[model samples]
Target chain A: MAGENMVGTVAIIGAGIGGIYLAAELGVAGFKLRLHDIDDARLADVRAFGGIDVEGERGGFAAVELATSDLRAAVDGADAIIIVTGGNAQAAVARSLALLLRDGQIILLVQGNTGGSLIVRRALDAAGCHADVAVAEMDNYPYSCRRLAPARIRPIVAKRWLQIAAFPGNRIAAVHQRLSPLFPQAVAAPNALYTGFTNANAMLHVANCVANAARIESGDIYKFYAEGVTPAVARLYEAINAERVAVAAALGASVPSLEEWFDRVYGVREASLVETCQRLTYNSDGPYQATGTPSSLEHKFITEDVPTGLIPMVALGAAAGVPTPAIDALVAIVRNMTGRDFAAEGRTLARLGLSGTGVAEIIRVMNEGFA
Target chain B: MAGENMVGTVAIIGAGIGGIYLAAELGVAGFKLRLHDIDDARLADVRAFGGIDVEGERGGFAAVELATSDLRAAVDGADAIIIVTGGNAQAAVARSLALLLRDGQIILLVQGNTGGSLIVRRALDAAGCHADVAVAEMDNYPYSCRRLAPARIRPIVAKRWLQIAAFPGNRIAAVHQRLSPLFPQAVAAPNALYTGFTNANAMLHVANCVANAARIESGDIYKFYAEGVTPAVARLYEAINAERVAVAAALGASVPSLEEWFDRVYGVREASLVETCQRLTYNSDGPYQATGTPSSLEHKFITEDVPTGLIPMVALGAAAGVPTPAIDALVAIVRNMTGRDFAAEGRTLARLGLSGTGVAEIIRVMNEGFA
Candidate 1:
């Protein structure tokens, strides 16, 4: 493989909360690291965080010295590329990377929201790259971090078991072996479908936030992980989980229950889901604080999550004959409120170039794990 | 016609705004009147207002003797009963009236919400007194008055048209003949179904109030008839109108558009619907102020209107395969907020003793008129 010597070098795109923490973690673990973000302000903030130190205790750190404006230049000689850009920015960044990335480079999406890996793959193909790059996804970043300022990141929790999978199911083990030393929580998920369906943040956050729009709009600063999970809210959480499960089943992915996934991610034993969320938020060293941007559920819950995440699940649920009334009502309400038909938005099956396949065929392809 | 001797005497139940103004209007016109209410204090208030005097001009003078009671005494020995009890008090008053009402007496329900005529009819049947009583309904009382205190009613707008009908269509002309002299614009509706379906207040108020619950809770109050009729709010109004039309179609009833109904009811040649509502509220010489209750929409909109009025329309819409997404979502959200399954609590075809009938059968029964 060309650039085999660059195996330990890592490139992280988009220095957002997720990208910054991962770069900090991996850089401190002795990996040669390069951090890049489109926002100049965000890039400056990362530079203010003492630059990525790559020669430290976790594995023998390598300082993160390289930062770039050009996406292609950022991933030119890197062994692994970790993408943490916004969902809107994903395709463009992927296109740029595909144009310059060489063979055998690993492109790992920290959170493959709305089939970001597939989108990236399509963009790469469009850019005419023939390299056999390993494209994979990790469902979501395995840590909870918040940008306290333009520069400072305060991580709340480092997840212990993060389910990761390569594009094709057969190559997951190989990817895990390479990433295992860096992510102690790394586990080979059944396929990309498993990762896609197991996105609890999107599932839980969307419903809770949307339903409580009144409370949120009134400037009731909600500790989302703490006070947000009341009994009624927990029922909403379960409903969302049910939708995710239905989608996973329809896609032939072996997904764990929300509670089980919670345990795996938090490394907590015998903790109820609500209690776990509460404990995380109420913790003294936790990232949650009294002030932040208005967590308008309209955007995160209805606009992004419902259309990009929940609608797909709902479609799959309908295909599988799983009645998801709560999810359906939510989708309808959001549609009414926003005056938009989310079902026709981007990443839908029709938009994804896979409109004709039946549920069974879709499941087979998802299980086989191709972009 | 054994009760023809007593036919000229009008019994008004509930000495609230509607009851008192209706009694005053009929009484001043030389009809013997008896006013009844559960609240003794409210009865004293009506008595203090000089009963009813209908001598000079429109809003000139009125004085009439009234006997008030809990329920039993209200319906006893009366020729025609006009029910103006609180929405929540309807079932109880209906039950009591069934026990005391004599054969051939007329029971007219103002604000004939969600099968109000049927509710009273069923109660009479249950009481084993299925006599030759004419159960009739009016779209609403002809005046709007407010109980400013225990004994003071501030008159608002007296309606121009008072559409009256009997439950079985046959008695509509006879019923209209008896009631028309008191209302200059009195007209015979097709049947009780038409009267029930033309309740514009219920249709417009419920959806807007429930959808804007957050704003209401935040203490934002606006003249519901005026400022609340903005474009966004009007969309909800249109949705409700559509549902009402669907219900009317299901029952084979002729339903008028809101604009047409407003023009007919208000007797204004060029006044828009919103303008009529505004004038009804602000016009001092109008009867609406004198007979209308508090401007709060919660009781009429949420409690009575939703379950009694809207749900029936929803059920009919379901039977007719017409989509009422806006209504459905509003009902669901209100039910969630209030912790009630309004559908089960609401009036339905089965509740009205027409469960298994086709539209033709219902039409035939309505045409035959109630005895």
Candidate 2:
């Protein structure tokens, strides 16, 4: 803890899966911790899980001396604020934090899917509290936690290396220094764009689950890590990866190949995306389950991945002249399968607030770090 | 009946559905009729149909003065022959006819699907027949019939138009003059390729059935005509149509739009291919039964349409700089779905024996008729 003395009280929001995991890790390492969540039951469970015993009515992790859903109370005395809310609740949480966050109090977003950091930054700007609150985003959460009960969480694999970066390049090292002690794996990405594009799991997993909706709805008997590597599925995986790479390239970031990411994350070697998915979900004793919808793949692949991930990549690919036939095909199939106008839902140059900029200008802006 | 006296003696081989219907039409029109089939029971049913009688037994139709399983006997005295056998039996039937047929006889093949005329022509060449035998093909037989019971034939809808064309070009008028009275709707197509591509039902209907196998097999009710036009299935129809159009263009023939063909064949305005199939097959009064092995659409669409119809189209489109994203997407999706390498499955240019020829050459050879 190089900054142990200087780093004051740390606030962990949501006390949900990610929040609980992070707070437990940090509390064990002797950091003064505050946890906030709307659910009191969750707070009670965290208290039982080795949190510092705090004798107060704010019954959270026994180690978390402060616990509340109040925005101001949570951020009042904090040096650092970490967000770990449900994906759907993120926008509201960001809006609330924008009003209450103080200057020089850093905001870190775990699992920053679909430009969460950028979204929160915009919220803070609208609230007139944008300066001095250095906002950063991690590609994914540092730890995997599943709920055992309403208040109980079971932490599984804590990722060994987490890529993160601040919106403004100036805050990179300072943010990393403050948060590194709480995570075993924390590294700075080039910028928010690099971190955003590297979160490939949403695109890959969602597409696979959606496309195989019939099989998934009947029963997810297949191992996603192994069977998902079938040649057909592998092509889809490649298409998705191609899109992600395109987005990263457009943003002037070097993104790793999906295959390399798979190797790093799951220890899969020479196996296709489908194979990797099948091995993990079907062959292994993992906690994955099938989607309930007939077009789950469409929902994830087309609705979520296309609108949020691939469409943005497609726009970028067009700029680069990289013929992404696989990505295009996936988009078409998902649209056909779902009968939704995904392009309308998608991130366009206009949607990404880059409307009027030429490719070069957009790339320059992205390279300069979302300022 | 103007050429009743000059009409040549006609032999219809294979007393199956097509053979029986053609024999019934021609025998009543005062042409010397001969019907032959391998199945004795089917031929017996052809005899039981009223108003026709035969003098001899080759296989079973009563209008045949002579019938025999021996091919030489059946072909010996024939002036014109119509081959109506199953596609799988094409080679054997062609060999039988070539061994015994005299020069100057006209052989009109019904349902020249999978290039049956080409197969027959190759077999005849192998048999070393060099005489001026006229080989013609009809897109499909002019009548729809089914076997109701042993020795009983059920006549359904008689197609209003039958497009016929003679290969080598010179004998077209003569073949039409001989068979015109028997078929009220006889018209001459430019060549076999025109007839092949115009039969769009084979291309679209088959793919729909195969892709929806799970729903079809599960007895989940489906109004294939009404509901199968879902955007996803419609995209598939478009993909299949694109392939057929490509093959037709390659052969220097005009391929009608699927919508246009449906109106012409089924008298339904704006009805999709699935609707046409439902109208034709699922009708209570229709000749076809509800249960049968899934038709060869699976093979045709996947094997033929993808490689022959789609791949060629994609290639041609590429050469012509036309963007056929719909066709391309379908090819990818089907390739992924079936895991079958359709490009290698006889539908591709190389497999179709058109390898090494530029686009112009392909068009010329198919238009000029098989050498």
- Which lDDT tens digits does candidate 2 get at residues A1-371? 34542456789888755687677656655778888887767677555554632212322342677777677788886888888874445556877777677667878877666566666676677666654788888877665545555444454445656787886645678777776766647787767767777776555654464344334433334444444334445665666676677767855788778777656655554544554555545433233323123333443434555666666666656655566666676667556545676778666655556666666665555545444
Candidate 1: C-alpha RMSD to true structure equals 6.5
Residue B228 shift from truth in candidate 1, angstroms:
9.7
Query: Which one is best on TM-score?
Result: 1
lDDT of 1 by residue, A1-371 (tens): 22343358788998876787787677666777788877666777456555643221242222567766667767878888988875556778878776688888888888876566666777888889789888888877776655455544455567777788777656777777777776877788867778878776566665555444444544555566555555445555766676678767766777878788766776543356567666656766443333242444445445656765777666666666677666676666556545567777746665444566677766665556434
* Deviation from native of the Cα of residue B49 in model 2, angstroms: 22
RMSD of each: 6.5, 8.5
lDDT score at residue A111, model 2, on the 0-100 scale: 67
- Per DockQ, the best of the predicted structures is 2
**What is the Å distance of residue B304 in model 2 from its true position?**
1.0
Please identify model 2 stretches exceeding 4 Å from their true place.
A1-101, A105-129, A140-162, A168-170, A180-183, A201-229, A239-254, A270-274, A287-298, A354-364, B1-231, B234-300, B312-323, B332-371
DockQ (C-alpha based) per candidate is 0.13, 0.16
